[model samples]
Target chain A: MIRHHLSDALLMGYSAGQLPEAFNLVVASHISMCDECRARLASFDAVGGALLDASVDDLGESDAAVPESSLAATMARIRAAGPVERTRPQVAPRRGLLPAPLSRYVGGDLDAIRWKPVGGGVRQAILPTDKAASARLLFIPAGAAVPDHGHRGTELTLVLQGAFSDASERFGPGDLEIATAADEHSPVAEQGMDCICLAATDAPLKFNTLLPRMLQPFLRI
Target chain B: MVRSESVTRADKPGEASVSKLVGKDEMNGTAEWVAEMLLVASNSDEAAFAHLFGHFGPRVKAFLIKSGTEPAVAEECMQEVMATVWQKAHMFDPARASVATWIFTIARNRRIDILRRSRRPEPEDLPWGPEPEADPADAVSLQQESRILGEALKDLPDKQRELIEKAYFGDMTHGEIARVTGLPLGTIKSRIRLALEKLRQSMT
Candidate 1:
């Protein structure tokens, strides 16, 4: 069972289709693992639904008129689209180390990931997303620790494999740690197994150590 | 419970009371649309599809345009959205989502695709088939809750309501939403939990 879940702001932004691509991916991945967040996200969607159901007069907009032939055109489009398949009982595909949404970006499961060493025993692969934010998969060897760092904007880290313990708490699989600007610490991979995480940041991180800070420009961490 | 959270200091108190009086009509309207959607799902009924299109098409277009899509593009996307509704009508589950809520999800997805040029990752589907048949009692209760939620939205103070609308219409970024509005979400959250409990039972 997942302990930490997404914030309301993230959920609502996702429901409204307004979050950055990287943030959306993280939210989607987390929701895949957490039923509580899934239900909460649906609630946020219902808000969007409520807004859509509003009458033209209620919104005080007299100008949102569709053309007379629009319905006929949609009907024509429907005919061209062909019939839908009969509804089938869909069991969710078995979840691997990566959730379904993350798998789409990686193209497969954990073995499919292409990892590059950032430094020390940590490896990272930056996923392609818009300029607004960055998402990456992180691999930290057992008993290793990332350099101390502070965030410029917000950092969302979701544990996908093994466990990691930071100053705050131990984050096992499906637990999300949302670190804001005020937080600064090094997260160490717990003993026994390598820790792999999906982490997204809206802004660049500030490494506390001078060496790591210098490497930041080249590493894009 | 949904009402009390939003009943604070309505700018137009008279208008708030007026909407309360019409709440019954809104609930009836939702039920009628749900029935119409079922007809389309079961029989591929053109008449029912057309009726749904008549009510929702303009609203969807307006929604897209408000989100800053060009009017022509919005109209085109609106057509695609309606087509998807027809093609995927068999997936409609009134026990889980009202017809308007279902359509809103489609419109939101289309808006993201046409404007953002980015993939919107969706959560994995809950392991379940479409309702073999919608539960009438569950459907009505869900509809009633949604109507009350809508009224609560209208009764919100203008500033609060506008902030919520701005978040939905793409005027506010996710970061901005964190700063701009502590939304009146107590009621909405409870309603969702209620719906989720019902859904969980049906799954079993």
Candidate 2:
């Protein structure tokens, strides 16, 4: 059973278009693999519909742009643009645990990733995305542990393959762990298999130990 | 949430004009009429398309502007969105969503596209939000769900609702909301989370 899940705040953030770019990627990938979250998000969208339908106060026509030419201009544009092709809803599901949303980031599947060694047995490949936030694909060999570190800002870590145990709890595929400024943990990959995770962080990691702290600046984690 | 009767009443602003020729007897069918207008517009029916443009255009513009879009850009986006509505009308299913929900989503997506294009200097960029999925479900069920959600939202405390409105309608981040409201980040998250929990409990 998929126990660990996205916090209500994250899902709501995703639904409302309020999340920053990097965190949104984690949410999208997790939702694709978790049906429960998908259903929950659908409910949120329904609420959005309800809000739009009832909201008459904000949509005051008096303040809206009413130049009649806009209608004509829009009509001309639509006429000029010609027809839009209908989109197919769902393709056959890809073989990988990384959903289409995440797969595109790495170019293809698990084998397609070009992992860069950060430290110890933990390796990561930073995905090119918004400069305000950063995302990366992490690979940890079995029995390897990430250094115990706190967060200066929020970091969302989603496991795409294998399982890992942190101070909080064990997380598997589709499980999301939200580590904020108050939280600190060293996550260890379960011995049965290699662990691969998609992580997004807005700030540098705050290492708890002297060795990791000294190495942190060069590690750029 | 939507009372069945309020839903019929919800279309008053749109049907009030169409009712001039179609008569008041057809007013209850207003939601279906909007969906049909999309279908008709797909077939290049200029009158039907123009009517849709007139009704949804201004509202979409206002919605975009509330999200920090400039009026000029919002106006441009509004036109672009309506044009997409016409071109992709076949995708609009009255059964799976109400007209308001459908149009709101279209407007939201269009605004996001515009925002992304303006910000991202990269040639190959991925979207930040969940891509719209094509779910085909019963029309009345989705409407009832939306109405229930609306009702659930009404029951929430004003303080909680204010946060939600900022997050959803105004496009404020949790941190941004904290800065503006002078509340701590933890407090803002807790309030919104609690209110959402109540909404989830009541709706499901």
Candidate 3:
């Protein structure tokens, strides 16, 4: 069981569809690993559904956007989807710990990724998401220390494999370590296993060193 | 004619917390009705689907509009959302959630997927993933949890509830909520945090 689970607030953001894609990816993947959170999310989803029920029907501006033939249009879309196909989820993970939700981004599993070195023996592949935020698959060799940095905004780093010890805690698979302006620490990969994490950041890192600052512009991370 | 009593109970001054007072048995029946309708729809039963569409579509459109999406976009998104619900009907498990909750979740996620589709220009099935597998717990237990959550939401003070709505239903960030409500960011955070924490305790 993952000790540090996503909070109800964050999960609410997720079920409400308010979370950025990066955080969404992290939460989705974590839910796949953590059943407790998954169940909790179901509760949140139920709450969302009930709220929708309680919401009064107002044929307001948004309702004006719908064509009178919306039901017909929906039926048309379903018919176009074909009759006999077993619902193949658009983004299916053929097989891996990546889970189906995160796999679609990388196009495949761990081996499919073509990682590039980002200094300090750490390698990263920036996953294409959106301008609102950036997501990447990061790899840290055993015993390597990530450059100490503070977050300018929000950063969610979810461990996919192995473990890493930050300033105060060791994060293992399914553990998501969130960092904000208030927290800054060098996350060091524990010895005996390589640490792989799916990291997402809404803003650039506030690095303490001169070298990292200079490279930030070119790296666009 | 099968209306939701729990929904109306919110306004029934005497039933300030009808969600808690209502036993699991009454809710289980409601949960099953929607589930069966979805199951029938999955088999291409038009009448059942139309029933769901009639109930959920307008609400979904209103929700999107409230969340700040353009009216046309909300309507368009609502259609797409209902379409997915129709196609994915077989996936709905009442054991995990009530039908209203499931449909609401689909609309919310579909809205997100549509928004992202514009930003990343990629054909993706997002807001899309397999629904969670049913927990080992009995069906009644799941319904009970849902009831608790619904009541927990009702028990929140009106101001807190408003902020929670903006947070979840309006899909606004803390900053966006602060801007709209004209309150300090910290106050916004506390209200929502306390509300959610209450929900958390209720679940436990």
Predictions in order: lDDT: 0.78, 0.65, 0.66
- Comparing 2 and 3 on TM-score, the stronger one: 2
Output the lDDT of residue B193, model 2.
38
lDDT of 3 by residue, A12-127 (tens): 66777776677777788877676566666665666676567656443444444446688888788778877634354454423586766677888888998889898989999998
lDDT over C-alpha atoms for residue B43 of model 2? 49
Considering every candidate listed, which one attains the maximal DockQ? 1
TM-score of each: 0.88, 0.77, 0.75
Please provide, for model 2 over B1-204, each residue's C-alpha lDDT reduced to its tens digit, 9 standing for 90 to 100. 222432343344432122233234443333444434544534455656666666667767777777778888888888888877777665554434556666776776676677772121111112211223222223334444445556677777788767767776776654554443321123222333343343335333
Q: Which residue pairs in model 2 clash with each other?
A: B1-B147, B1-B148, B1-B150, B1-B151, B2-B147, B95-B139
Which 10-residue window in model 3 chain A sums to the lowest lDDT? A85-94
Q: Candidate 3 chain B — worst ten consecutive residues by lDDT sum?
A: B117-126
**Predicted structure with the largest TM-score when compared to the true one:** 1
Interface RMSD of each: 1.9, 7.2, 7.3
- For model 3 the local lDDT of residue B86 reads 70
lDDT of 1 by residue, A1-221 (tens): 67778998899889988887888999999988887787678777877888888835454454567888988898888778776775745766566778888998998999999999988989999898887889999999999998889999999999999999998789999999999999997999999999999999989999988898898888887
Checking candidate 1 for backbone clashes, the offending pairs are none
Residue A184, model 2: lDDT of 82
lDDT for each residue of candidate 3 in B1-204, tens digit (9 for 90 to 100):
434532342233422232334444474444444444443434466755776677677778877776667877887788888877777776655455666777787777666666663121211222332333232133334455555566666777788767767776664762353333321122222333333343335344
Clashes of each: 0, 6, 1
Candidate 2 on A1-221: residue-level lDDT in tens? 67888776776666666676777788888877765665565555555555655454555666566578988988789769876565434444367766887887788888889988877988988887776678889998988998888998888899988999997599988788888888988899999899999998878888888987887767666
Whole-structure CA lDDT of model 3: 0.66
Model 3 chain A TM-score equals: 0.86
Ranking by DockQ: 1, 3, 2
